[model samples]
Target: MIAKQVNQKAWFMVLPVFLVVAVSAIIPLMTVVNYSVQDTFGNNQFFWVGMDWFRDLLASDRFHDAFLRQISFSAIILAIEIPLGIAIALAMPKKGWGVPVCLISMALPLLIPWNVVGTIWQIFGRVDIGLLGHTLAAMGIDYNYTQDPVAAWITIIIMDVWHWTSLVVLLCYAGLCSIPDAYYQAAKIDGASRISVFRYIQLPKMQRVLLIAVLLRFMDSFMIYTEPFVITGGGPGNSTTFMSIDLVKMAIGQFDLGPAAAMSLIYFLVILLLSWVFFTVMSNIGEESSNGGS
Candidate 1:
């Protein structure tokens, strides 16, 4: 066989992107790593502290609490949003004027900025002027997110679901659209029930996009900050203080650079590890299903 020449020039075309990534991501990450290992007390003075910060962070009850809260929030949102999104997507019209209306409505929430979302919800949940709060109060339910931990938690969770579930719905809808009419036709000819049709056709066909949706939602929920911060301010006594919130309070709020840096690195690693696990398990399941079908 004759050797074929490859296009080495592709490397040159990609070099600009590599340089940009190095400057934007790699450099900042290195700075964070540098800060993670040392203590500073003004005048650009930094002293090596080895792993003391990481040790303290690991032992601290505050960090553990924040971590648990973060985990719970992520789990709750994923549990709710995935099913809700799927149901909404399934119920949507396949054609006609309703399609554009439904799509626009779904996309409106996603188009709003994070901070704007928080602000809107914050006002909407106010007991005095907010419609939701006033209606609840008029109905004699003592709903107050500002002073009640349960209310605060509920508000943030609902806020997150409102803001992000649209993303999952859109992705799932796209996946569903990509599926051929032949599958449904075959299922109809076989007289398969709705559940069986979904399980054998729709669900399996949407697996790849569902995986993407799951990963995106997980990461976003796990690191959630702005909405909760603006609405609850992690208040009602640290009830909504997630890992990202706590990290900011430590680094910027208290100016504890060393410990904050350590915590940030640990936070990054935890996210990376969990994402890997999710990808691995889901990919394995996908492969097994494909093999079985083949």
Candidate 2:
């Protein structure tokens, strides 16, 4: 029997990333965890409070409302962006000078800073000297996002769609480009309808990329804070205050560090669980897709 030697040098390559994560993510997470179960007074004084903060947060109406709003917003975002992205990607030119043009146009929105996107939309949605708001007013529509909950929600959603749908389009377009011409040729030889070709060929081929798009959009939307916070200030009376905003309000606005830490942990768990569920379901689908006889 021959002995195989294992290289220990690979771990050295991974050590830097491990140290970075420990410094950046894990250390902060542990600090939060420590705070979640303890009460603190000024001057770094701390008293163990067990699960009191978590219990209070779980029982509070504010947390409940924020959770519901967060999930709902994420759902609406996914529903709108996924289908809209697919439609746009399908319509975009696959080749020629037009391809680069369309890609650059889509990529432009994504390059803007998050706060800048919110600022742009804020001004863009104002009735005075703002294009969208002014146009809506001229059309006789009452469209004040700062005061109206519905308008606030719509503005936030639209801003997200405009900013992030480009990501989905690019991912889907890449998936489309990767599909071999042989599949389309065979479809044409079979005299397949456009709808049939898409259903059987393009869709199946795009499944992996579509899964990636969904997960990315879902996580990003769920954690969205900067854009909405800047646009709405979590106002129109807390109607647009999702979990992230609520956490900020608790931690910074009210100076409730213990409760904020606990709430943050819960919020983190919810996202973690949902992402796991999505990954599991999508992985199974991918497996079945590969296994199914064509």
Candidate 3:
């Protein structure tokens, strides 16, 4: 019998990616860590703050308020987008010219820059010159996002939905398309209703992708800044201020480097924790499904 040799050359193919990540990701992370631990007071002067900034942030009411706002926004976005995306995907045809057209149309909003989306909506919602605002105002609706908290929240949420629902739709559509025809054929043979088929077959098949969509939307909505910043400027008494906006104000606007960096790290860790929970739950579901299938 001939001795077998293990091939180790494949690591070379991955070396470039490791190097790129270290340069692009790791180095910046270390810098942020350094900033988080030190206080700077102009003229490049620095003093060790240790965990004082973290303690202050934890005690701050502003931090709590911002976190709550972020959570609410993310929850609202996920609730609206996930079902809407699924419904749109389900309504889409599986084939034909319409498929590409529909995909292209759905993808258009996502392709627009975040700031541009905010600007478009900001202008579009103007009560005087813009079509939507003018029409609503003409109908006697008191719609002013700048002064009204509810209106500001509604505008920001609606803008986010319009811009990001396409991502969920695309992911769900891909999952839907991946299902083999055999499953549908079996459902048809069994005289199953469309609802029954969806609940029993389609939903389970798309669970993994749906989990991903939910997690991504949650994180994105939680950290949302640019759109809301441009549209509402975190105004109407900070009703629309999320964590990222607050962090920006702290770091750039106030030049509180230590506190801002600490907040940023906390924000990042929260996202990481949530993502990990989502992944673990989804993995368990997948495992349960596999075992049940067997």
Candidate 4:
């Protein structure tokens, strides 16, 4: 018997992407690592500072507050959007001309540029001239995001939901559409209630897509910068100043490169860790569902 030799040329085809990633991601990451432990005074002079920046960041009240704010914001939106997305998906027309219309409407929000969404909302939320703000004020509600911290948070959170919930809806809709008709027929023949069908069938099928949507939204919301930056400018006195905003303030606004680099590394690690945990939990649930179904 002759053994066939494996071709090694596939790696050569992948080489370009590897090099591109190294240049774009790895190089900058190493540069940040270099800056994380060094101090700079004018004239490009640098001195080693070891882990002092990381220690300070861990001990800083501002950092802790920003982190808590970021976590809270992510939690609030995830709580709202996941169920909201699932509901929207379930309510959508599954097979009709209306499906395309509904999908297009959902896609429209996602197509808007992030900065444009922020600008549009910023203008749309002004109590003097903006529609939402003006209407609320005319109704005798004191809704001033600019001068009010709670109002500022509310505005930002709403803007994020409007811009991003569509993504979840689209994902869940795709997951729902992929469900086979035979399962529905079986459920109908068995006289299963709508709630039972959903709980036992639809929810299990949607687990994977929801997992993807959750992970994506978690990372996006956690690292959010542009939308809130343009909308609230992180304010009504740091009420909405998230981790990313604070990191930018340290790195660019204050020129604290060492601390900023350390914070960024920590931020990256946190997202990585959390995403892995989400993926693992969802995977285990999926496996258990499959096993139980079997």
Q: Each candidate's lDDT (Cα)?
A: 0.94, 0.94, 0.92, 0.95
How many clashes (backbone atoms < 3 Å, residues ≥3 apart in a chain or on different chains) does model 4 have?
Answer: 0
Per-model TM-score versus the true fold: 0.95, 0.95, 0.94, 0.96
Model 1 weakest lDDT span, ten residues long: 2-11
Q: How far does residue 19 in candidate 4 sit from its true spot (Å)?
A: 1.5
**Local accuracy of candidate 4 as per-residue lDDT tens digits, 207-279:** 9999999999999999999998998999989999999999999999998899999999999999999999999
**Model 1 has how many clashing residue pairs?**
0
- Per model, how many backbone clashes are there? 0, 0, 0, 0
In model 4, residue pairs whose N, Cα or C atoms come closer than 3 Å (at least 3 residues apart or on different chains), thus clashing, are none
lDDT of 1 by residue, 83-129 (tens): 99999999999899999999999999999999999999999999999
Residues 175-285, model 2: lDDT tens digits = 999989999999999999999988888888888999999999999999999999999999899999999999999898888889999999999999999999999999788
Q: Per-residue lDDT of 16-101 in model 3, one digit per residue for the tens?
A: 99999999988988888998999999788889989999999999999999999998888899899999999999999999999999
Off by over 4 Å in 4: 1-11
Taking all chains together, the TM-score of candidate 3 against the true structure is 0.94
Q: Which candidate is the best by lDDT?
A: 4
